[model samples]
Target: MKEKIIIIGAGVSGLVAAINLEKAGFNSVILDQSDRVGGRVKTDYREGYQFDHGFQVLLTQYPAAKKYLNYNLLDLVEFDPGSCIFYHQKKYYIGDPSRKLSLLFPTLLAKIGNVADKLKILKLSKALKKKSFDDIFLAPETTTLVYLKEKGFSDEVIKKFFKPFFTGIFLESELTTSSRKFEFVYKMFAEGSAAIPKKGIQAIPNQLAAQLKNTELEFNTSVEHIKANELVLTNGKTLAFDYCIIAAEAWPIIANLKNQESAWKSVENLYFKVKEKVIKKPLIGLIADEAALVNNIHYQPIKKSDNYLLSVSVIKQHNLSKDELINRVEEDLAIYCDIKVDSFVKYFKIKKALPVMHTVNYMMPPSETQLKDRIFLAGDQLSNGSLNAAMLNGESAARAVIAKIKNGFINVN
Candidate 1:
């Protein structure tokens, strides 16, 4: 008989785990507390607009994503290669001239950084391109801020460009995330486009979930406690399993698990419907002001519709009320776009947007994935905070389980 595996959390990790297990001739059951899939990567449609749970983009070059996902089916809409930096009461356009030749003159003239700084960007990209994924993550670790300074990036560029840009990505104002993560993300951006599915970000997970033929997904089913070879549900029911995988954030469920990081980064995304396009191009806008409450903005045009959907992200949580926050965001948008924005639609304050990891790895070893005799753990927290990491760890855990089953190391009862 095939081993009865129970995987917790129907997020990308859990879904991928089940997919891989099924390929290896073992079927698994997935349990999730939420009503749907895509734990943090969900999307909501409101009044003819699609708003992702948070401002998110899928880097098309993610190795694991490329391996598993069918991008053509996603109907992705790509963002322009660079950013429109709002600095000192002016908008400066900067882009990778290598990718788009038209951006060459604009990037050179943009005052966000010096000519040498721009050249250094190309050099950095070239250097990172030669470094393999293993090399990037295994290199000595340090804060991204320190790494940039060591690379001789000027303060002007770091402040007006890298700081605001990566702050939005990392969800941390300070560039204190590991340099390894920065390199990995930078490599991804340099290699491919940052895009979202025409439907929404949730489509990525929906695609993965749809591929499961043998796995059973049980939603709104919470696992209250994980025990030895069994699970206790919140409704006072228990079920036995030959193997269990904690594909969710393990720190919360497994009490004895060590080295699990629970600290999470937060972000607030405020959406608005505008009559005119706030940004002509599909490029991310960064607020370079040190004290600006609005960290970044993107205006996504709704297909076959007259109105455009504007998404403004604030990396920090403030004491301001919803009205106050909206007012401040409107003020910022007015200055950035030179047009008034008052059509406030919704605000998404996500407290656990991304896991905070000081140290990161490309993948975890099989031996490390096994928490106990018959239990395992998998998530982005096990490696780095990215969709790529989540999928990588999930497959890693699934392979570990497959190896054990093939070796007959663990008895199936």
Candidate 2:
């Protein structure tokens, strides 16, 4: 008889784990508390406009993504391999000259970075390309800020470009994220373009979830407790399984397991609909001012439409109400463009948007897939908090389960 597997939480990791186990000829059941399959990645439509839970982008060349996701089916919309930085009351364009040779001199001439800093970027790019992905992760680790300083990057460049860009990406202001993670992220950018599915980021997970053949999905069914031989559901029912995978975030898993918790960063996203396009091109505008209410603004382009969908990410989390925060963001954005505050379509405040990665814990061992007592864990926090890490770790845990089953169920504590 095929081994029975129960996977808790229907996020990307849980879904991926189920898919892999089913493909390997195991009977799998996926249980989720929420009604939606896409946990963090979700989209809502209202009044003829679409808004994601938060500002998100998919790197077209994420190594793990290519292994499963079909890029053509995603119908991706690629952004230019550049960014428009709003600095000192002016907008500056910094682009990859390699793709468009014409922008080589202009990007260097732009005030975003000095000649030396620009040269360092190219040097770092080439160096990263040469190093294997594993080597980059295992290299000497430190805070990203210190790593930049050690690499001879100028303060101007770190502040103007690196700080704002990374702050928006990592959802942190101190730039204390692991340098190794920074290296990996930079390598991905150097290799591919950042884009989103024409539908939404949810499309990525939805595509993965659609491939299950022998897996049973129980939506709105929460698992209260996990055990070595069975799972206790919130509705006072227990289901038996040979192997169980806990694929939720670290905090949720820690709470259930009664373990210490890790810190996470929050984000406040506000979406606006404009009558006409504000930024001419579909590019991200990094707010250079550190004290500003808005960290970055992305102008989402709709095919053959003059109307614009603006997604703004706010780094600071204040106790102010939604209207108050929206007012502040509108005031700051007015300096750059003429926008109506009343044009706001939706707002999303995500408390645990990103898992913080400090240098001290950056290289620590990933969460144990096979617990001493026979349980398993999977999530982005086990690696770094990225879509690629979540999917990869899920598959790794599934393989571990398969191997254990093949070996005839090891000793259980």
Q: Per-residue CA lDDT of candidate 2, range 275-318, in tens?
A: 66555666788888766778889866662254577889998767
Tell me model 2's lDDT, rounded to 2 decimals: 0.78
lDDT tens digits, residue span 79-169, model 1: 9889988887788888888998877888999998788999999999989878899899889999999999999999999999999999999
Name the Cα RMSD for model 1.
2.4
lDDT of 2 at 237: 92
TM-score of 2: 0.93
RMSD vs true structure, all candidates: 2.4, 2.9
Angstrom error of the Cα, residue 31, model 2: value is: 0.7
Estimated TM-score for each candidate: 0.96, 0.93
Report how far off residue 303 is in candidate 1 (Å).
Answer: 4.7
Worst 10 residues of 1 by lDDT: 404-413
